[model samples]
Target: MTLSLNDLPLRDDLRGLTPYGAPQAPLPIALNVNENTHPIPDAVASDILDDIALAIRDVNRYPDREFTTLRESFAEYLGHGLTPEQIWAGNGSNEVLQHILQAFGGPGRTAFGFAPTYSMYPLIAQGTGARWIPGTRQPDYTITPEEAAEQVRTADPDVIILCTPNNPTGTPLGLDVVEAVYEAARGIVIVDEAYQEFAPHDAPSALTLLEGRPRLAVSRTMSKAFAFAGARVGYLAADPTFIDALRLVRLPYHLSTLTQAAAVAALRNSDVMLGMVEEIVEQRDRITATLEALGYTPHESWSNFVLFGGIADPRATWQQLFDRGVLVRDVGIPGHLRVSAGTEAETTAFLDALASIGSAS
Candidate 1:
């Protein structure tokens, strides 16, 4: 006799909700997703093809579950003395976050972060049945140490997530503030540095804070800087013990042989990748300055995007831009929109579109 499955509770939290998916549109300047607008350089493309061909030979077997070589290469590129055992790889940083939630979050636990930051943190927490507590950021979109520490002490969350160079707002959390949170956190503190490549002056990475903080994990993604959004490679750097806990929850042979090879190839040519980053940063500054001149107050961004408000109505402004063949991200925050820095040509087109609209008005 089949047991009555209908009586089972559906986790109680995730019931009646549709899955999240990014909106699709015809690719017009395509600056909504914060992707690097530059295509892979031809020389780099050739190198990646060579590496992928070599990796194809190993396709018959499962990839090294440890992903030792890739992790070591990444550590070397980052100039950190990290071992393969101290790292974990996944399809994307999003998946890595899910693994963290599963390993460290559950009922009676809470995950804390600053609101108007990365949109994924709360979703991940809720998916795991953990309480999500969002602290408010300062008017400038920066978080204060005292505020974060107080939240940790009062809420006593089991996990804390900080996104340096935060999304949709493009503001970087000060290193001092991050260190303060690290000191005060009761459990795991994840520093998600998905946009680190665009940061000014090589801001201190959370990897430097990992020696004493066994509860810290720093997540990175190839999708942003390396322009491998299509490849879907992301990794975490943490203490070996923390990585082991992540290992327990991650699927076996999760990183495909192709992805491993692509990451290694991307890491090996980091100098080329950095050149592209320089270009993007230069373009970002130009865009920010132009937006300010247009009377749009954009946040000081260290990422490859600029976020601004005061468009009268953000949804209306977004609709206007879309009508002009430009697609931008209109975050639900009133009068706020985030636009990625694209190639010079794309930036010019976006500016031209906005100018045209302003002139028509």
Candidate 2:
């Protein structure tokens, strides 16, 4: 006799909704969920361990309530003339986003994002009691400045979220669109740049646009390029006033001592930690090229994953790859699947497995 949600007290809006996540399975090669499958270098890992051990000694006392040193490190790493006063962080980007919603969105306020964007936007909105309004995207998944501004003007939401180098589909977003959307909306605007470190070197980040725009925020994470997903540190840059708002909503001393210490150690070794990004990018491009040669339409990607279409039966193909011990994502988008760029060996395994299954006829 298993009791379900109907048998218990639950929020009506969340009654039938499922949690946001990808399928987890043990496989020899996993490219799903867009994780950086590369391991951190040994030297950096050793340094992190040393820091964590020291932090453990202070476990009896609460960690820094302001996390001042961590914020300063992030500001230096971002290098858009940012300062500690404008920085905010949380356990992960998701928690940082939750704080935003809690501060600026709730009750009658509405949050807006382009459809087929990050799935968590709506869930976070719902959790904060904010109405989630979904805008549209072009057929190729790109959005122009005019279209984006028009949508924002029409929805007139209290919050707007933009995911650059978007998830599930590897579409790149231009800063012009961000500017236009910001001009059209009177509310808070958040750009989720969790994958920004994987973008092209010359590409300008939204941080460059944050100079005079007090309503804008650019959020990033150590999960992908730094291979720090297990460490769970995410941060954002915004106006000092805006950061103060998140402080109002964030739990007291949210980041643990060990977490701050580990992240600081990683940031200090930023160059060495990011060295793996080049290799991962090579594999990502390789996946794209091989996918096209197989008659699949691979979208141009700035992130470390490729989303391809032209699968005759996505579920069947996914199962075939899984049977071969190679796992990719079927992101619920018809005729398409996504794969993260793993180590060279893992990428080879995925490619071989995909090639064995013939292309869509």
Which candidate number would show the highest TM-score if scored against the true structure?
Answer: 2
Each candidate: what lDDT?
Answer: 0.85, 0.93
Runs in model 1 lying further than 4 Å from the true structure: 1-11, 359-361
Clash pairs, candidate 2, are none
Q: After best superposition, candidate 1 residue 200: deviation in angstroms? A: 1.0
| lDDT of candidate 1 over 7-26, digit per residue (tens) | 56766677665666556799
* Candidate 2, 262-298: lDDT as tens digits: 9999999999999999999999999999998889999
Error of 1 at 128 (Å): 2.3
- Candidate 2 regions off by >4 Å? none
TM-score of 1: 0.94
- Compared to the true structure, candidate 2 yields what TM-score? 0.99
lDDT score of residue 108 within candidate 1: 78
